[model samples]
Target: MPDWNLVGKQHVLAAIAECDRLGSRDFLQRYRFGRARASTVWHRGQEYDSKAILGVAYLHATGRAATADDFTRGEAGAVDLLQGLGFDVVVDEEALAAEKAPRVRKTTATKPARASRSAPAAKPRRTTAKSDERVKVCPTCYMALPATGICDNCD
Candidate 1:
């Protein structure tokens, strides 16, 4: 709950509504005017506490506040009201505990498998003189001509 004394009642109400709609207390704090100041405000010939109203509005907007009693009892009352409305109050402890537990890993050291011996590499075949004689240079493009003796580039 925050103070609403320094800021206008309408502004405080708007901030509370916005906070409730968003379901975020941080949003309210960030957008609240005179966030550093706290003062009492007179509304409808009565003192309306900004912090209390904000808290109640938050509970109501979040579907936690069912009646005026919820506002009177504060957070615990709001929780009870919310529970009465069929909301699950218990969290899954088993799942959370499992998540926190450290994982176990098996570490085994073993010698690397021996590499199989490979056969000796064969020598590359040398190009014969007849192979060179079969190739001809194109006179038009000064490029190597294919077996058809046609200059693709010049054409």
Candidate 2:
């Protein structure tokens, strides 16, 4: 582990100056750094990333940049280090929740309930064999005629 004792307020200030001069994206790239997720350092009414600033400050102190794995992060880490230097380091609840929580779904319209039982169906009519015997067949025309023995086809 690199000596944390070497990091001073001047180094942190220089890192902040470098970040503002080069902009966050370029400054981070120059130092091989990423955005701080846990805590952000607030100075001169501007919010700076905690991890990058501290890591870059460590570089400013020793001329060699410290990676994320170089030191611990929260209580006894960057926060503690920055706090020792009298920097306002705030751990935003929103940032922590955003990193850990899943995506939220908006409430949608409720669907209509389905019927439990179906509608009553109509019953089919039944035909009997005795009703079929009542029909008379014509003799000459060979057609089923009325029971009066008169053939409509023959007439």
Best by TM-score: 2
- The pairs that clash in candidate 2 are none
Compose the digit string of candidate 2's lDDT tens values, residues 1-155.
76989999988997787678778897777555678877889999988878788877876676566766676533237878999999999986676657555668899999776689665778988876331233344455323344567875677
Estimate candidate 1's RMSD in Å: 32.6
Taking all chains together, the TM-score of candidate 2 against the true structure is 0.57
**lDDT of candidate 1 over 31-110, digit per residue (tens):** 23222122222333433333334443443333222222223433333334334433333323454355346679899999
Candidate 2 local lDDT, residue 25: 92
Pairs in steric clash, model 1: 5-39
Model 2 spans > 4 angstroms off:
74-76, 93-155
lDDT of each: 0.38, 0.72
Off by over 4 Å in 1: 1-25, 28-70, 90-155
